[model samples]
Target chain A: MSTVEHTDRGPLSREEMAAVVARDIPDGSYVNLGIGQPTTVAAHLRPGSGVVLHTENGMLGMGPVVTGDDADPDLTNAGKQPVSELPGASYFHHADSFAMMRGGHLDVCVLGAYQVSASGDLANWHTGAPDAIPAVGGAMDLATGAKDVLVMMTLFAKDGSPKLVPACTYPLTGVGCVSRVYTEVALFDVSGDDVVVLETWGESVAELVDRLQLRIARATRPRGPGRLR
Target chain B: MSRTQFHTAAGGTTAAEAADAALSASGVASGMTVLVGGFGMAGMPVALVDALIRHGADELTVVSNNAGNGDTGLAALLAAGRVRKVICSFPRQSDSWVFDGLYRAGRLELEVVPQGTLAERMRAAGAGIGGFFCPTGAGTLLAEGKETRVIDGREHVLEMPLRGDVALIGAHRADRAGNLVYRKTARNFGPVMATAAATTVVQVGGVVEVGALDPEAVVTPAIYVDHVVDLRSTSGEEHAA
Candidate 1:
C-alpha cells in the first residue's frame, strides 16, 4: 500500500494559525478554548500573559495537558480530556460554570467551525447528515456568551469546497456571533455581510477574492510566511 | 408496588429503601422525566441508576450531560429501551451506539442543549427562580419561539427552569443527615440536580457520622437530599462487583 502525497498553497501552519489567534488575546482576559483545533491555542499563549483559561466542565485557570500518572481522571476539560490546573484554579458546579458563560463573563472564545457565513453566523455543531449524531455541547453557549468569538478552521473542506460562504447551509449554532476567523490560508474579520481580508498565506488576496467571489475589503496587503519568523 | 417495605422521610434521613422504594413506588410509569448526574463515568449514581433500570420504567425522558458512553451505565438503561426522549448536551460520542441506533431507527427523540444552558436551567429549577435570560442560544433554532430581550445592549434569550420527577445523583461522601460532599470534577451536575427534582436520591461512596463532614465542604446540604445509599458498604460492593 502506498500513501499519496499532495501539496497546497498555504503559509501559516495550524500552530501558526493558533499563535495568530493567541496574539490577539489581551492581558487579564478570561477566555474559553473550544474542543478540537481550538484547544491548540493554549500552547501558544505568551508567558505571563495573564489570560485566564476557563473550561465549561466547571474549571477556571486551567493549566496545560497532563499525562501519565499525573493525570486525574476526574479532573478534565469539557472534552473529557485529562488536564492540569494552574495556581489559583477554582472549581464549581456545572450550573455555575455556565452562569459565567451565559452571563458574558468571558472575554473571548476560540472555536472550531464547519461553516461560517459571511455575515458571522456559525454552523459548527452539526453537518445535518442523516446518520450523524450531532454533538452541540457548549458551542452554542460560547457562541453567544463570549464578547468576541474567533473561529479557527481550514479555509476549505477536504473536498476543496469553501467553508466561508454567502450563507451557512447547515443548522447554525448561533447567528452573528463570530467576529473573526483564522483559517489555514487566511485571516478574515466578518462584519454584517462582508468579509475583510486581514492577511493571506501563499495565495494572493485578489485571487482568493476572485475565486470565491468574496466581497473583500483589503485592510492591508498579504505578507509572506517569513514575516512571522 | 411494595408499600409495606417503604418508609417516608423523618428528619433529614429517610429509609435506605427510599432510594429504591421512592423510585419503585413512583410506579415506573411511562412518560416520566428523570434527572441523572454524570459526565462520562465520573460521578454517576450507578447503583441508583441500575435500580431504576431494574425497575423497568419505560418511556422516560432522561436529562444528563452526555448520552451514556460504552455499553454499561446509562447505556444499559438506554439499551433496555426504557427511554423515549433524552434531554442532553452531547448526545453522542465515540461509544454512544445505543442512542445513535435508537435515534436513527426513530425509536428515540433527542433535545440537544448547550452544556451551560442545561446546567443553568436545572439551577433555576432548584434555586426557585421562575426563569432567566441567557444569551447562549439567542440567534439559533433553539431560540425559536422563545422570548428575546436586550440586556446591556446585547440580545438575550429567555430560558425556563427545568425540573424532574426524580433525580439520581452521586457524591463522594454523605453524612447521616445527607449533607453531600463530592470528589473533584465528579461533582458536575449532582448539586444542581439534587435541588431540581421532586425526589432526590444520592448514591454516596461512603456514609459518615452526622457530624463527620465539614460544613464548609458540603456541596449539597442535607436540606436538598432526600435519600442516601452508601455504595462503599460490603453489600454495595457485592452489588457493584
Candidate 2:
C-alpha cells in the first residue's frame, strides 16, 4: 500500500473513515470501542469475522444497537445506550469486567482524543474547563491495558488548530500508549517523538507537515525494478 | 474451616413487614455508610430505598456506580436531603441533576472513582483481601497521594478495599433459603456488594420454594444474604395453601 499522497486528494467522510478502521481489524480480536465516535465502529464490523465486542459495563460479545422489542433495558453499554447481546454472550460483575480490561486481556481499544503528542501521550478526558464535571470513566485503564491503542478523532478542532501536537496541553491519560491514529484527514503511525505519515487526504505532504506544526517522517517508497540501492 | 452458615428466615406478615425488619436491623443511622447496587437504573432496590427514605435517617454516605438518575430510586433519597456524601464513578450523567444541584450548593460531597477501580475495590472487600495494586490509574490524578510501585516495569497504584454498614441489592428471584439469581445485566454489582457489607438486604421480584432453583444457577449464595423482601408476594398466598 502507498503510504503517502504527494498530490492533494482531500479528506474522507465519517462513514468512510469508520470503514477504514473497521477494515484494519483482524479476525478473532477482542476489541473495546470507546464511547461517542468510536462506538460507531460496532456497526461496521465485518460479518462472521469472529471479532468479540466488549463493553466496560460488564458485557462481552456485545451486539449492535437494537430497537423496540429486541432492546433490553438491563443490557445497556457504559454509555447507557440500549444494545443487544449476541449468541454466546456472557455477563459478569463489574470488577471482573474491569479485570478483563486492566489485566491486558483486550487486544485493541479505539478511543476518541482531544490531543495526542508525537511521543504518544494521550489527553482526551478533560480540557481543564473550570465548570466541566471532569468524569474520567475507563479511558485511563483502556489506554494503558489494551495491547494496541488506536485513537479515532478529527484531524483538527473546530477552531482549525492541530490535534496532533508537539505535546498534549490537557491532563495526560497514559504515556506512550497510542501507536496508531485514524482521523478524517489521514492515518498516522506514531512512535517515539515522530509521526510517520502512512496515508494522506485533501492535503499534500508539505501542506500536512506545515499544518501539523510538528515533524512528519515520511516512509520512503521502494525503488523501481533493476534500480540500485 | 467450615463454609459460611446461612442466617435469616422467610417469616414475615407482609413484604413491607419484612422490609421494616431488615431496615431496622441494618442499624441505619445518621452518618452511616451504605453500599447500593445498580448500573444506571438496573439492579436498583427501589422499594428498599423507599423504605429507607421513610426511615428518616439523615447524613448518609452512599457508595454505588452512579449517583442518581431522573429523580427516582437513589435519586429520590438524595432529593430527600438524606445523603451527605456519594462515593461513585460517574456522578454527573445527564439524568443525575439532583446530585449536581446538591454538589454545587456545597450540601453533598462527591468523591469520584474510576469505574474499574471502584469495582475492584468493592470486590477486594468481599473477597477478604486487604488491598491490591492496580494499573488502572497509575499516572492520573486518581493516583495522587496514593502508594505507587512499578511491577514488571509498569506503574501500579495501591487501592484499599471498600466496605459499608449495609448493602441493598436487587435480585430477580430468591428461594426461601436466600439463594439469589439476578436478571441479565441487572446483576452488574449485586453479587460483589452483597459479600462486602456487614449486612445485605435484598429486594427480589419473586420468591420460590427451596430446591426450586437449579443448584448450578445460584449467583449470590444464601450465606451473603441477610434478609429478603419479596415484591410480588405481598399477599403470601403463593407460599400458603
Candidate 3:
C-alpha cells in the first residue's frame, strides 16, 4: 500500500516557500509573471539565470522591482508597477506581446489561484456571485497557451477553507491547466487520483491535516493521468 | 416581409474600390460610432482611414485597442478633430496632441479595461456572451463604481461587452468574396472586431479568387465581412488607397 509520511517542522515561512519555488524554475526560461504573489518571484530569481520576463503591455526582458530611489517612472510592468529593465530589454507594440503569448513562444507562466483541483483545474477568475465585477484578463489565454503553468497560493483561505478541493465551484479559467502548486504548507503535484503532497514543510500528513482541519487520504499507488476526480 | 435594398458593385473591381463602395453604401455620416481594428501600427486600415479622413467625417466615437502613435493611423482621426470619444484599453502616448488634449481636459470619454479582458469582451460580444467576471482589477482604482460581489468570500470584478456600428479592419490579403487573412502582429484585434461590429470593412494588400485561399488560411471568414477595399501604393508611399 502507498503510505503517507510526515516531516519534523510544522509549516514553512513565506520566504522559505518562495525560495523553494524559485529553485524549481529552470534557468533561461521565458516567463510571464501574473499579478500579486507571482510578481514577487521576479525578485527571487537566482543570479546569472537568464529568465526573460514578458509583460502583456509589450515589454520583454524586465528586471526586478526597483527600490530606494532608482525606480524609473517610465519603466513599469503590465500592472503599471515600477520596475527596472534587464540588459537587452526592448519594447514593441502590445500586439506583438499577445502574439508571443498566443504563438506558443512563452515557456512558463506563474499565476495566483483561488482554487486548484486535484485534476489540475484552475478557478481564479470568478466565484459566480451576482454582483461580482468580471475581469477575465489574459488568464484564459495564459492558462491555455503557456507551455507550463504553476500556481502560487496559500493552503487555506483566511476563513480557514481549503483552496485545494475535490471540485472548484468558481468559474474556471482553463480546464486541467495546473502543473504544480506551491503553498505555505506543502508543495503539491496535481496527480490523477488526488493532490499528491510531494514535499511537506516539516509536518506529517495527519498533523498538517489536523492543523489545517481538513480531510486527507493516503493512496497506495501513483494515480495515472486523467484519473483525478 | 419588408426588405432593405442592397446594391452590388461590378465584379473585378479592385479591392480598394470595393472597400470604398461598401463604406459609401453603408451611408456613413457625421457623428457616428466606428470601431477600428489593429494593435498600434500593425494591420491598420490605412486606406479606409485615409478615405474617411479625406471625406471630412467628424464627431466620431472610435472604439479601438490602442489609439495609434501620433501623426498616423487612428491618431490621424484624432488629429483632424474627427473623433469625439475613444473607448479603448490604452490610448495615451507622450506627444499625441489629440489624446493629450482630450484626456487632460476630460473631453475624451475613456473606458479603460484590462488588455486581456478587453480582448475577451470583444470576443464575447462576437461570441454572443453577454458578460463575464474576473478578479484581475479587484481592490484597485479600476474597481471603483463597478458592481462587486463576493463569491465564496472572495471578490471578483465584473465587466460588460461592447459592440460598434462599424468596424474598420486591416488585412494582409483578401478574396474577392471577402475572406480575410492577416499577418503576424496585425492579427491581434482584427479577427475579434470583425465579428462584433455591425459593419466590417476590410482593407487588404492583395485580393484573389474566393476559393484560391486555403480553407485553413481564412482568418476572418466572408460571413463576418461586409465589404472589401484594395490598397494602392503611390509616390513611393504605400497608402491603403
Candidate 4:
C-alpha cells in the first residue's frame, strides 16, 4: 500500500470534521469514546445503527448525551458528564468494565491524541508539565487492548507544531496502537508503509502544506492502490 | 480472650513485620475464610496475599469487592483454585473464567452484593452497627434470603454487618503506632474492613516512625489496626500478580 495525500483549502468547521470522521465508523461496533473530541462521536452516531457504547465505570449500552430536564444527577459517564442509558442497558462491577477493555472485547476505541508518531505510537495521557496531574486512568489498558485504535485531534498543537511527528516525546500509552487519524486539516491513515492523507478540505496538497508551513513529504499515490471511496 | 483482644495482639507488629507475623500467629489451617479489602486492583495487601498463597492456604472463602485483575491482585488466588467462595460486588470479564466455571459447576460459591450496600455493610461492622436497612436491593434477586421490613410505607432490605476472621488491607503509609493513610483510589474499602475483622492486617508501602503521619490524615486509626506489613521494595519486579 502507498500513502495518499489530499489538499486543504481553508479551516474546516468542527461539524464538518465530525461528519467526516463519523462516516468511517461501521454499524454494530462496540466503541469507547475517549474524553474530549472523541466523545463527540457519540452525538453523531448513525441512527438505527447498533453501536454499543462502553464506559469504564461499568455501564454498557450508553445512549447519546442527555439535555436539560432529562438528565439525572447520579447518571454520568466516566468523566462524570451526565449521560442517558439506551434500552437493555445494565450495570456491572467496575472491575468487569476494565476486564472488557483488557481482554480485547472492544472493537474500537476512539481517543484524543497529544502526539502520534509515524509508526502509530500514542502519547496522550501526560505531558510531564509541572502542574499536570499524573493519572493514567485505564488509557494504557484501552490503547493496548482495544482491537483497533482511532485517534481524533487537531493536526497541530496550539503552538503551531505538528502533532503527527517522526516520534513522540511524551509518555506513550501504547506502541503502534493507532490505525487512523482524523484531524482538522485532513484525514490520514498511519499504515505500515507511510502516512497516507486521504482527503483535504478543498485545498490542494501543495497549498495545504504551504499553509501549515511544514515540509512534509507528499504521498506519490493513494495507499491500497486506489481511493477508499 | 475476646475477638477484640485477639486483634490487639495482631496489631502490635509493624506493617513490614505484620505479614509473616500474622501468618505465623493465625495458625491459618487450610480451608478457612479470608476477607480482603481493595476495590479493583488497588488497595490489595500484596505482601499478606503473597504469604497466604505461598503458605498454600487452599479451599478458602475470599470476600472482597473484586477478585483483582489477571496476573495480579485477588485474581491470583482464584486462578490458583485456592478460593472456594467469592463474595464480591463485581467480577471483571477477563477474570470471569474463574467465577463462571466454578459457579456453574457448583464448585465455587459466588455471592453478589450491591456496591454501595457492600461498602456500607463493612462500615457498619466497623462502627459496631448490628444491622442497617436500605432499599437498594428490594424487589430484586438480591432481596431473596435477606430480611425485609417496611417503615413509613417504604420497603427496605436488612443487610447484616459482615465480619471475617481475618481482614487484609493496603495502605500508602503507616506509622509504628499503626495509623494508616491510603493514596488515591487505593483508599476504597480498606478503612472500612480494618475494623470488621477479628484480625486486621495492613500492607503499607512505607513504615515510618510513630507520629510521622499527620493527625488529621489518618484514615484508619491505630485503635482499630492490629498489624502492619511492609510491601517488598522491589524494582517494579514484584507486582500484584
- Candidate 3 RMSD to the correct structure: 11.5
- The stretch of ten residues in a row with the least summed lDDT in candidate 3 chain B is B1-10
Task: State TM-scores per candidate.
Answer: 0.87, 0.91, 0.54, 0.49
Ranking by lDDT: 2, 1, 3, 4
Off by over 4 Å in 4: A1-229, B1-18, B232-241
Model 1 agreement with the true structure over B14-104: per-residue lDDT tens digits: 3344456656754546788999998887787776777788787889999999999888878999999999999999988988988888889
Q: Which predicted model would earn the best DockQ?
A: 1
Clashes of each: 0, 1, 17, 13
Indicate which candidate wins on TM-score: 2
Candidate 3: stretches off by over 4 Å: A1-24, A27-30, A33-229, B1-20, B151-154, B232-241
* Per-residue error (Å), model 4, residue A162: 47
Provide the lowest-lDDT 10-residue window in model 4 chain A: A220-229
lDDT of 2 by residue, A124-182 (tens): 88777776666777888788888888899998999999999888888888878997888
What is the interface RMSD, in angstroms, for predicted model 3? 9.2
lDDT of 3 by residue, A1-229 (tens): 2533436656767666667667777888888989777887777778887888987755789877776698554456655566777779866444346657756788888888999887888888666675443444566667766777888999888898889877777767666778778888776777345566656666676766676533455444453112112
- Assign candidate 4 its CAPRI class: incorrect
lDDT of model 4 at position A160: 80
Alpha-carbon runs more than 4 Å astray in model 2: A6-9, A191-193, A220-229, B1-18, B234-241
Ranking by DockQ: 1, 2, 3, 4
Error of 4 at A22 (Å): 20
